[model samples]
Target: MNLLDPDQKHRLFWLLQAGGWAGWALSFYLGATVWGDPPDNYGFYVPIIAAVGMALTLGLRWAYRLTWDMRFVARVLPFLLGSYFAGVLWMVARTFIFFSLFPEQKAAFGIESSAEFYSYLEGAISAAWVMFGWSALYFGIKYYILLQDAKARALTAASVANEAQLKMLRYQLNPHFLFNTLNAISTLVLDKDTNLASDMINKLSRFLRHSLETDPMTQITVDQEVAALKLYLDIEQVRFGSRLEVLFSINPEVKHALVPSLILQPLVENAIKYGISQSVKGGAIGISAHKDGDDLQLIISDNGPGLDFSQGITPKGSGVGLENCRERLKALYGRSQSLKLGPTLPHGLTVTINIPFSQEA
Candidate 1:
């Protein structure tokens, strides 16, 4: 199925070679019949000439292949000389075949003597032009193919880099979350709350397991991503207890919409860390998703201290998580996706994400 495969390329080359020569023979025959006086057995002669031209060009192809890696300037001389010689050889073969097929025509033209090579001169010049045309077309096609190959390589490299960047961003969340969770667990252990500490460790294990199992390069359904988010939130819930409140308002229609794995985790973590933890009476975190025209709109907001742009664009302690989400979205969807931060209601920060809505087949 891959036309670029070596065997397929060879097959394609032969197909083009056979087709081009066949077309040339047909065109030559038609032009002679319609635009000029037809010679005896001319139909037979044209095919022979076409076949000879194809054979000669095959030699030109071999020669050109040898110089394929050479610079343009270096290739020019070989192309010119090879085409010229091939053209002259083609004409020589055509003249011999023509004379053999219609012996009377040579006598009628008063060129019975083989020593006088002038008879082949005009034909050779015309044949050289034909070969030159073929050579030009061949090189043009080769240049186009090389350009396509280069473009394919560049795209592949970009895809690899994009995946690496996404993985780096994705994996960054784990250690950041893990460090915070472990610190919380350590505090509980120091306070002699073994029961609470054990429960937190169990939740942390499940969250880490899910995180490690999921591939950053793969996408998960909104429902699946939310489930994973809950695993992380479960750990935080244990730590926060009644001090933290979580809410979900996911639309049923968009539940199965595909999104990058753990895309919302860092955002939610930022909300909890910077928003709820900052307040004496911890604020409620709201997560919602719905279809917005052609896009899936996901919003995570917190009723904690809102961002102060006077400080800078990034909220204090929220830059890494927000920037990670932003870069991952850009890597996944380029400009087709967007993440925006704004004030929520009377207080706190709201992050909105818009991505093209898609589902698995």
Candidate 2:
């Protein structure tokens, strides 16, 4: 029932216009009945006066519409002059009909024919004030509708920008990971390990197919995301062989909880590249997810050489992935999500993420 909604503007305008004139006619009839000696045909005259006024004002509406885009100050004189002239026209029409219907009212007042011009002038002034009021109301409503339209456009533009930013951040990770996997496959091919290279290529194909099919702007359930991760891990396992180990400790209660699509891939990639691959005895990566009251908490940890902030050193290529994850989370959840990097129990790095717990419908 939003009358001001842009879709309903035309219907609302006509309804208000008819209703306003009907009220004006009713008030005129009631006033004449209470005080003045109304003629037997006064009801007929009232409607004619109202119809003439409505028709003249409709023309004024057309004129005002043409000036809608003008500056407010520039429009003032036009509105005033237009309303006054329309009012004079309406007054002339009403007077002709009134005197024609009941000529005796002129003689009842004992007014001379010479004074008719003065009476018409007085009536025109009153009609002008009425037109001025209508003009003010028309402008008020037009401005309100314009303001609402501006706000709606601003919100739509903001939403579009937000979606584009999220898509950019999400898509950037795919190419970074793709180049690494392709290089690995290349290495295996050069080493003449045809069997391993073939298997890695198959797994990489399935992973990429899934990645392409899922939209970057969508959220997937924890279980589905973990399934995608396993596909990725299959390819990585081929490259690292026995050197890479992965452990998943997912709570069944939170398996249906939702997270951004492909949210964990870059984090796992970082662990594999900077932690496990850096060690002679390649390390194990542990990923766990659980519900923490109203939040979903995910932790990815590795038992490898941890970051040494004391020496102001960080793993190469770590920032891009971590920062990408951080930005995506911020864009999706605003201030309600967090990503923190810290040391694991003994000698590794752990990335912890906290996001609002929401389940798929």
Candidate 3:
């Protein structure tokens, strides 16, 4: 049946090799023993020769894979051609080599070209068909093996996709979070200062608008997300005033680069909560983005309480924000991307996000 599957292919091959050798050797022994053939008839050389020929077929598919148009016909066509050639070579070479290697076997099988002088032409014609059958079986198994391998790969990809979809559904953003934040803004205005509350509301509106309007499939440009983050900081500044300040050193190339929706929102929120809020005088939050080969490197660092002391700085909430972002990244990009939170150059918290360019930023 299907032979190409990674598991089945090798198993099939070993089975074929072992079976073929056993069958061929048994048949030779039976015929020779029944006919009172010479002792040389039971030599292992014949089976070894046949096994080597079958091994050649295994590599044929790989050689064709590199050359083919990736179509079934194209890939199999070359392999078939190679299989035919290899089979013929195996048959012809093995017959001559083994016959010559042991002069006694040539006489035992009644196949000595030296003794025949083309006298057994009728028998030779029949023997040719027998060799052809062996060759055909070898190639047929390889063809089956390749098909099985393709199906296995497809199944693996589908399983991975299914898992990712489950994760995405589980972590899908909650609209209720926005509603709650809106209610917080309303309370801030009534129970707190109106001007500061107004600024916060305005910033919150921009952030909500950006999040709601972002293209779900094609990623939003990094610059757009950063611009939205700036608005968020502006509003938070109104609330924190002298307690919060932000500095950005962003690469121009990545501004238009693609990034997932609201990639920076919650991370910045976490930074503010732990970094500046914990500091007595409130320190600065630094944001930077750059290109690293095929990936975009984003660093968000804040001067706040450090983590574990030895590693550097720590954020306030033990990093629920970074974990959420990490979950989202795995859902979207799997292992193709990464998000890491650690200490910055100074005694502060730093969050690093690696976005792949091939995944479009």
Candidate 4:
């Protein structure tokens, strides 16, 4: 198992084994020297003992990586008994070979039993402790690394989702504006209002130029978005002159706050199409921007019919304009930012937008 896959049942199995070996080397000086309250006489054999224990763990980890159901008491129960027997076997073999070669230091076994039997049991228990310590450390480190990787992946996914939403908003903007301007041009040609048509065309060209020029990642100042909206309003006024009026009340501190480009135009367009166009007396669109604690709030209201929740429509809001704006807000700032639609004070429609703000802005 490649320990890197989080979804795998036995992820980090091999990684833990490698880490186990490393920990054993650190704790016992690679088994070249024994450690305890009273140092052993044969400290020089530490490396050999450490090496054998680590090798066994490495081999066993590969052979019997526990499955989902085997990870409980059943797996834990047999490990100690099996290790005890294995340690005793290895210890006896080493004791026999060493004592036969060097008859002196026969006292090294310390047990009345034959040197082979004594060494076998002693070495086994010591090796078992080393294996246990390292295995636990290895799994601890693996768990930590996995947690960090998961957080990084979640952050990356959120960033990608935001970029996708902005692209969707860009798609909504281009076609929506083009159709309206073309319809205006058609009306101008039919009425022969050549001068107004030329002016509208110029303003539309400038608005598009400003929008397409900016980098998508950069947060533009609220002033810039408002300027783009004004340019668009100028063009629309030529076609809807005497039918549209715009009133703006902006707080000085909020002017330099940042927002996505063209954020306000969609709301204003909704006002014009749904309110002013329908009323015989025409209507006024009021825009206000102010700071409320850590939030930057921008509101636009028009004296028109409010949203019809049952029908799922509002003054041209059923199209991509307002919905695209909502999607962009959700994507960029998530729930930290919000847009709300409701009835205006004197019987019109209002859209309120609240976004996080920086003191410098």
Judged by TM-score, which candidate is best? 1
State the C-alpha lDDT per candidate: 0.88, 0.88, 0.67, 0.71
Encode model 3's per-residue lDDT on 231-339: one tens digit a residue.
Answer: 7777677657888989999887777887776678677877777778787898889899899999989888888875655645443344445666777677678898977
lDDT of 4 by residue, 246-327 (tens): 9989888888888877788888887888888888888899999999779999899998766664555444356678897888
Q: Please provide TM-scores, in order, for all candidate models, with all chains considered together.
A: 0.91, 0.84, 0.52, 0.72
- Runs off by more than 4 Å, candidate 1: 1-3, 36-42, 107-117, 309-318
Weakest ten-residue segment in model 1 by summed lDDT: 309-318
lDDT of 1 by residue, 1-361 (tens): 1127688678878998898889889988998789978777898899888989999999999999998889988799989999998988888888888878987777666685766546545645777888998999899888877788788888888888988899899999988888899999999999999999999999999989999999889999999999999999999998899989999999999999999999898899989988999988898999999999999999999999978756556543346888889889999999999888888878988999999999877
Q: What's the C-alpha lDDT at position 297 in model 2?
A: 98
User: How many clashes does each candidate structure show, in the order listed?
Assistant: 0, 0, 13, 7
Once fitted onto the true fold, the runs of candidate 2 whose alpha carbons sit more than 4 angstroms away are 1-12, 26-43, 104-117, 120-124, 309-318
- For model 2, how does the per-residue alpha-carbon lDDT over 197-244 read when each residue is reduced to its tens digit? 999999999999999899999999999999999999999999888999
Model 3, position 258: C-alpha lDDT score: 79
Which 10 residues in a row give candidate 4 its minimum summed lDDT? 30-39
What RMSD does each model have against the real structure? Answer: 2.5, 3.7, 13.6, 5.9
